[model samples]
Target: MNLSVNVQEEQGTAVVYLAGEVDVYTAPALKETLLPLTEQSSTTVIVNLSDVTYIDSTGLGIFIGALKSSGKAGSKLKITGANVRVKRLFTITGLNEVLDIEEDQREEV
Candidate 1:
């Protein structure tokens, strides 16, 4: 599946909404969008993955890089809206404690 990223300015944070699969082919796009945001001040980056279908190691690595980059500049990068399967991946990889991840809960229809 194709990856789609939509970026919006939320309060003082830059929120990136992601959908579809994030793998080797699509990681660059995300990187391009995030790296620049990490370089600045006065804003944090919040990556919202509610609609993301899948994410490979490369994608995870990109997040790590963003975290580091933002940290160097005294900013923060956060993640939210991850499903159980994705949350499991983060836990198994020991990134659950390292990264700020928010569980996604949807209202029943």
Candidate 2:
């Protein structure tokens, strides 16, 4: 299915909550929502994937682009609450080393 993206502002941070599948079909919506936040100077953009069930390479690419945007804008990008499978994708791609991913205590198989 479809990906649901919601954004909330907390202090100086923009938190984006995502659910459902993040594939090529849904990546554009995510990019639209997330990219602008990353472009804001001195802002912190957090992508919360706690409710997301699936994600593909296209979704990962969006985050990578957001990371780059954040750097150029002097902002911060963080990803949190990723499931085991999703976290493994970042690890395998070696993005975990370059991106700031907060550990999620909940584990899923």
Clash totals for all models, in order? 0, 0
Q: What residue pairs are clashing in model 1?
A: none
TM-score of each: 0.91, 0.96
- Indicate the residue-level lDDT of 56 in model 1: 92
Model 2 residue 62 lDDT score: 96
**Over the stretch 75-102, how does candidate 2's per-residue lDDT look in tens digits?**
9999999998899999999999999999
Name model 2 segments beyond 4 Å from true: 107-109
Model 1 Cα lDDT, one tens digit per residue, 1-62: 79999999867799999999889999999999998988777678899999987899999899
- Candidate 1 deviant stretches above 4 angstroms: 107-109
80, model 1: CA deviation in Å? Answer: 0.5
**Relative to the unseen true structure, what is the C-alpha lDDT of residue 51 in candidate 2, on a scale of 0 to 100?**
91
